[model samples]
Target chain A: MTINKELMKGSTVILILTLLDRKPMYGYEMSKEMEKSSSGVLTLKEGTLYPILHTLESDGMVESYWSSGEGERKRKYYQITKKGQGLLKEKQREWISFRTAVDQVLGGGPA
Target chain B: MTINKELMKGSTVILILTLLDRKPMYGYEMSKEMEKSSSGVLTLKEGTLYPILHTLESDGMVESYWSSGEGERKRKYYQITKKGQGLLKEKQREWISFRTAVDQVLGGGPA
Candidate 1:
C-alpha cells in the first residue's frame, strides 16, 4: 500500500542512516536499495533525499565524499559517522517505542 | 520514553480516531485516556489535539457537539463519523505496511 507522505516524513532520517550503517552508498544507489529491499513500499524521492542528506551532514550525523565509479562518473557517497551510528541506534529505539505506543492505542480502544 | 515530536506528528489523527471509534469523548477525557491506555507513552497535548479535531470535523471524519458534564461545565465532545472509521481502517493498514517497510529496510541492509 502507498504510505501517506506525512507519515513517511518521520522515517526518512532513520531510513537513510540505516542504509548507510550497512555500507557507504551514493544517493542513487541508496534510493534503489531502499525501494528494492522494501519491495517498492518506501520510495525516497531524489529531491527529498538530498535535503535530508545535507541536513544529516550538517548535523555531523553523516559525511559525504566524492568517488569515481566504473564509468568515470563522479558521485557523492554518504557514509555513517560515529555520531550517525549513535543517532541511528537512538532512532531505532525510539521507533520501537513509538510503534509499541501506537499499537497500544490502536488495539486498546477505550480505557 | 518521550517520542520525538516529529515522529509523533504522523500518529495524532489515527490515535484520536481510534479513541472515538470506541466511544465519544471530550478533549480532556480523550487526552487522559490516551496517556492511561498507553501507560503514558502516548501523551496528547491539548494544543495539538484541538487543531486536528477541527480539521477532522471539517473533513467530515468526525463531528463535535457541546455537552454538559459534571459541575454543569459545557465541553465539546467528538465522535467518529462513518468517514472517520473508514479513514482509521485505511490508516491502520497503511501503518502496518509502513512498519513492515521500515523493518524490511532496516533488517535487509545493503540489498
Candidate 2:
C-alpha cells in the first residue's frame, strides 16, 4: 500500500517515543529493533527515523550518549527521560480513547 | 498526570489524520470532535491542531473549502483525499504491528 506523506509525518513522533520507551538504543539499533520487532512489517528508514531522533533529542524528551560496541564504531544511544515516560502515559490514554470512539462509530451507532 | 511535550508532538499527526478519516471537518470542528470523541480524555488544542491542519492541506492529503454557516461564520471545511485514505491504511497497519511488538516486550517473552 502507498504511504501518504501526511500520515507518516504526523505519526513518526509517537512511534519514536513509544519505541524509545522500551530501552536506550542508538539510531541504527532503533531502526533495526523496529524492523525486527515488527517482523519487517514496519521498516523504519534512516532518512525518516534520524530526523525524528534529532527532533526528540532537541525537545529533551530523550537523552543520548556515545558508546562503542563489537565493531568499535561509536554510536549514540538514546534513553527516554522522566518527561518522556509521562508523555507515553498520556499518549496511551489518548490512543485508547480515540480508538474507542472510532469503534463506537464503526459499530453502527448513530453517526 | 502531566503530559509530556514530546509524546504530544509525535502523535498529533496520526490523531488528526485518523479523525479526518471519519468525515469532512474544519479545524474547530476537528478539535471539538477529538475532545468529544475521546470523552474529554484527548483534547486537541487549536495551537497544535491548526498548524497540522495547515501542513496537511499543503501536503495535499487534505483539501479545504469555505462555507458560511449560522452566525455568518465562514468556516473552512476539510476532507481527506484518496492519498490520505491510502495513508490511513498504512498507519493502521503500522500501529497494529507496533502495538503488538510492545505487547510482546511487555509480556516478558524476552525483553
Candidate 3:
C-alpha cells in the first residue's frame, strides 16, 4: 500500500506524544516500542525519531534526562510534561472528530 | 471527549500531505480545508499551520508562490513537490499498517 506523506505529517506528533505518555523513554527505546507495538510494521528510524524528539522538547511538551545504560551508553530519556498531556488530550478529541468526518465521507459508521 | 496530543503528532503530517494532494493551498486555505473536511473538528491555527508550512517548504517537500488577492492580501500558495508526493505515499502505507496494529491491540477488526 502507498503511504501518504501528508498523513504522516498530520499524525507523527500525536504518535510520539502518546508513546511518551506511557513512561520516560530514550530514543532507541521509543523506536523499539513503536516496532513492538505495531508488530514491526511501524519501525521508526533514529534519523526521523530524534529530530521529532528534539522538536517536542523544544516545544516544551516533553522533557528529557540523560541516563546511563549497558555498554556505557548514555541515552536521553524523554517524558511527557503536563503541557504535553494537555496537548495530547486536545489532539485526541480533534482526531476523533476528524476521523468521524472522514468516516462519514467514506460512507462508514461513526466507529 | 479528551483529545490526545500523541495521536495528533502521529497523524498530522499525513493529514497535511493528503490535503496538499488534493490541491495546492495556502496556510489559511489549508486550515479551512481541515475544518471543512473534519466538519469543524480539526481547526488549525495560523500559529500551528504557518510553522509547519514553512518547515515543509524548507525541507523541499512543498513549494510556494505568492498570489495576490482582493483587499491587498497577498497569500502564499503551496504545492507539493515530487519529493513530497513520494513522501506522502510512504506515509500512507505506514499509517495503514500502524492503524491495523492499533486496531488489533484495541480488540477491533482490521477495518
TM (chain A) per model:
0.92, 0.79, 0.83
Instruction: List lDDT for all candidates, in order.
Output: 0.89, 0.67, 0.70
Count the clashes in each prediction. 0, 1, 52
- Candidates 2 and 3 compared by DockQ, better number: 3
Question: Which residue pairs does candidate 2 place in steric collision?
Answer: A13-B10
Model 3 misplaced stretches (Cα beyond 4 Å): A1-38, A42-111, B69-72, B108-111
- Across residues A1-99, which tens digit of lDDT does each residue of candidate 2 receive? 223333344345656677777778889887887666655545578999888788778888899999866878888889889987787666666555544
lDDT of 1 by residue, B6-109 (tens): 88877789999999999999999988998987888889999999999999999999999999667878989999999999999999998899889988888875
Give me the displacement of residue A94 in model 3, in angstroms: 8.3
Winning candidate number (TM-score): 1
Judged by whole-model lDDT over C-alpha atoms, candidate 2 comes out at: 0.67
- Candidate 1 regions exceeding 4 Å error are A69-71, B69-71
Listed in order, the DockQ scores are: 0.70, 0.15, 0.15
Better of 2 and 3 by lDDT: 3
TM-score of each: 0.93, 0.55, 0.54
- Chain A TM-score for candidate 3 is 0.83
